[model samples]
Target: MECVWTRNGSRCGEAASRRCDRCRAVGYCSLSHQVSHRSIHKIECDRFRRQMNRADVLSDFPFTFYVEPSKVQVVSFEKRCSFLARHGVHGLGMWICECSCGSSLINFDTISFIPDWLLSSELCPCNEPSISLQGRLSSWKDYCEWRHLPLSSPAAVILHWPLTVYWAIQLATGCNLLPEIKNELRIHYLGPEKELLQLAAFGELQALFPGVRIYIDFVGPAIPDRRSDERIDLHSYALCNDTACRCKTEMVSKSQAVRMQLHAGFYHDRYGEFSK
Candidate 1:
């Protein structure tokens, strides 16, 4: 038997004698090995807790609308009206949203106008605006503190914008709908907030597509920008020319040649920025 902690080429060939006290699903050769493996195990543990939490939260709610998951498709304004009418909730001041899981329908209050970005074809599974905002804000604050980055820094500036994370993932996967099933996806990030909103986005994607192999390339701090008032340049971070940075080269090597893919014909100027 061998130690079960497999991370970054770490493997304990020694005989396994101890099991995790919490899950009891893995064996470790020594107490030190079990302690060392806790970091990676925490991710899965947290995911399990979140699943339980979701179940608990939804336990008391009644299913107002029930549509077979297989029959659901992207709905338009007219289609939304039909859906509302079918559910006998038309003119009830409700907002409809599709979950990121590609199944289940969410109804929101119609008091506030939902932004196109939030209501677009691809939306978060959480569906609730307050939950989404709180999650993003908490992740942002935790990431900033963990990375020891100032709130006013360029990296912080980019990480604070959750939409940027969405754009980055879209650019990396070359898909308009995020959290899509994929064999593997690689992302190269250049900034201090390495585990900011991007981490949260990746977590969501992982939950949606459990088999996805996500590889992240952290390229340290962004290149300095002389033209901009800020010390760190946004453009340089968007498009790296340094030979050491493998973003461009990796994109070129891909079969799709995504480096040549332009977003709204402004890929070269301000590639990462999300436009209306």
Candidate 2:
């Protein structure tokens, strides 16, 4: 993947001269760019090191797939605030999740206010909020602080497909893929989903990538309730050992990921209290 440079709203690369000697990750067309970029580069370089060390942090299991953001799309202050204010009545909003993978994931209807996690992330992009995700104004002429600081809870949902689906769909479409993937990663693959949120993400991806096939087996004990939220009440000791069976062969990998469809109605809460 080639690194393309965008400056002054125009992209230029391949012809650029100076490059970052540290990771050899970025390039500059002039000395001014190098100097101006140093502050951003210092943090980026440290983040790069942490990403490299992620694998060293003890693994609970071998990774089967991993998905990350392809691009950083910024929504303006007006757009973000308006969206949130309108949607607040429903306790829904979107926030940015800057994945360790060097991409930013847009999480919609997520329950958060300041998105402090994003602010604390190494991928915050800039120290000031004026430079919001979309490169819009950092300081509000009226309020005086960084634009993002004064902003109330997020208004619009930052829709995001499951990390798994994000990668799967990209691999399938090829053209719709994120530019960062083409430039940075040599091999981008989708791993298995264990958490319910991850599984939901997979379901969304499946909807998007209709062409891709997924094989699931009824390995867990049969539960009378197929409801998605009912999963929490299901037996926790379920296990499957039929390695020679066709189901095992069809699955992404025997121990890679687990899949169990939950009934709908997960978005709403019912039966206010415990019923006999």
Candidate 3:
């Protein structure tokens, strides 16, 4: 594990050999660095502990991909990486950013803190709405409760997308779609490369903005030429094999929530077309 501490604009890339005794999740390259990062790390230390003690959901998967029960339950940070490595998903896309900002300067090795694999992801959940919360969302605990998923559920990895949209819309235009506001929420989702593969994930928007219809204009040059402009009425959620999954329940059945319109072109070149 890499150093868990970063001071100012600097980072300690030294191998983290010392872990926090209390949580046994976070690590440090040295004692001084650990002391330096305590104030910020203190906030999420307990969260790290809670994340470790949760039930192992991997073994419960109904599909044929059955790993050993012992392999599925990972409480150690080193073992967590090893487990992901076996599946070829050990944070391969971690620290990746597509923003126009100075994301290029971000160095993965020297990154300040390494988030627990299942917690806030590259989707950046920490960047919440600047306006009043309106009881829409307060914390991850409440969100997992509302979604009927456990804290250990690997939902945040992808759920970050819908949550990001919820935060972005509010931060930009202060559009808080409270339960009473039964309005159609339209989003111009630009630059959709990987997201196109899992379009169903955006369906979580229905839950994020309950009672409000969401129309997603997925405009990007990555769209296939054959489907340059197409409208898809997302009538249902993706099928799930697990009976315990909410997607398998009536909460998601027959739900016509998200409508998608694909436009295949660069947003800059198609600005005039989109403006119309």
Ranking by TM-score: 3, 2, 1
The TM-score, computed over Cα atoms with residue i paired to residue i, of candidate 3 is 0.48
TM-score of each: 0.20, 0.22, 0.48
Which stretches in model 1 have alpha-carbon errors above 4 Å? 1-163, 171-181, 194-202, 208-210, 222-276
> Could you give candidate 2's per-residue lDDT for residues 1-276 as a string of tens digits?
222344553444445677766655556777776676677566556544544444343232111112211112233333444443343322211122322221133332231122111121121111222332332211222111222322221211221323223434343345443352221221211121112222222332222222233322111111123422342211111111233423222323222222333322211111111111
lDDT against the true structure, each candidate: 0.34, 0.29, 0.52
Per-model tally of clashing residue pairs: 0, 16, 0
For model 3, give the RMSD to the true fold: 17.0
The candidate that achieves the highest TM-score relative to the unseen native structure = 3
Model 1, 1-276: lDDT tens digits are 457555554456578999766555457898988888787666556544543444443332221122212122223223555654453433321122222221133221112221111211111221211121222222333333333433222222122333343334543344333465357655444342223212322223322223445443333222222211122111111222233433223221122111111121111123234221
The lowest-lDDT stretch of 10 consecutive residues in candidate 1 is: 258-267
By lDDT: ranked, best first: 3, 1, 2
Tens-digit lDDT track of model 3 for 1-276: 667576553556689989888777767888998898888677767866764554243233221112213222242333444444453434434312322232454442333212222222222222212232346563455565555445544435445566667755644344232333457777778787645544655665665665567888878756776666667655444433344533344343334357787777654334445545
